[model samples]
Target: MVKGCSLSQNGSSSFPDPLLYRQLVGRLLYLTNTRLDISFVVQQLSQFMASPMINHHKTLTRVLRYLRGNPGQCLYYPENSPLHIKAFSDSDWATCPDTHKSISGYCTFLEDSLISWKSKKQTTISRSSSETKYRALALASCEIQWVTFILEDFQLHYTQPALLYYDNNSVRYIATNGVFHERTKHIKIDCHVVRECLQKKLFHLLPISTHD
Candidate 1:
């Protein structure tokens, strides 16, 4: 909702003070831990805290009203799920306006329950959709490593290869194959790391329809 804010101010005197505006934005950001739906909205509001106007305040208030109307909303997980680990990853190609950096997002699940998730902008620009997907896969692999260690701590063993699902077929092929395409040479480390995981039989990559 904060993304709907318009920077309309009648005059300079009508604008809210920067410090107070930032303080409010900070509080909203803190609330995002239990409210994942508000993360995108909070992040948008934070960007305009420096010189907020009445229009920006309107947008912020709308977000607050939304929360007030849905106070009981919370993430719930069911027990008695299977022990198998699975992950899904994807990347938006050059979604950022300023840097042309892609955003990598992945969600890990232990059966029906979501165990881990991440949404981060890539540090470098990717030249192809396959490269964007590769970066996302690398991030998902790191998450799998961490989760595997935690499971080992509990004396639970995952004998089967950890399943990683990707919607992009090109990236899946690249992961299963050792040869690198010309477009992917820029991120050689990512290619090597994913290839190594495949060889070690630590994880398995699978293709899933985008609809899934």
Candidate 2:
């Protein structure tokens, strides 16, 4: 779970027992269902299931140590929280040393309470940071739309254009700008779903400093 730590399948001996590593990673994956903080790290560890290495085991132990040190930590929701929806999305572009795939992470809030979150690697490699970020935004937007539908089913209505925060200005520009350029044409058509949501006033994209 160390910040800026990138794991790879290079320059390390294979673990003697890959089964143990797989079992441990499976448990960690289950933990991520509630432990959003560990989701990214667990996703990174899962990539080595086919052949885990010594360094991977070391990193897994570190995650276990982190869990031990923070046994009481958990996501909490308060009763009577407001029904407004907001989301934050980000991606680490081409961070996977083996496949060179990007990792996307997003968290959704019902007012001030965290309600949903995810961390997963992109299926296809992104050629630019903007593309990677835009893909992340698209994923977050889809989740927001689903959440909005569920809320409606329960008779909870929120204001139009739910707020979505991203650190990439280019992505915000792409979502709002109608024109497409050669640089953006290569991006998958499915990823443009965010722009459709924007056109429908489903969500407003805002730029934020990465440190924020």
Top-lDDT structure, candidate number: 2
List lDDT for all candidates, in order. 0.76, 0.86
Residues 1-212 of candidate 1 have per-residue lDDT tens digits of: 74423333333343456787788789988887667677656765675666776666777788889989999987678857667789988877875554677878788888767777666778899887878889999999888878888989999887777898888878877777656444467777888778777788878898885553
Give lDDT for model 1.
Answer: 0.76
Off by over 4 Å in 2: 181-183, 188-191, 209-212
Assess the local accuracy of residue 74 in candidate 2 as a C-alpha lDDT between 0 and 100: 83
lDDT, residue 81, model 2 = 82
Error of 1 at 42 (Å): 4.3
- Cα lDDT tens digits, model 2, 13-108, are 999999999999999998887888888888889999999989999999999999999999888788788777889999988988778999888999
The Cα error of candidate 2 at residue 2, in Å, is 3.0
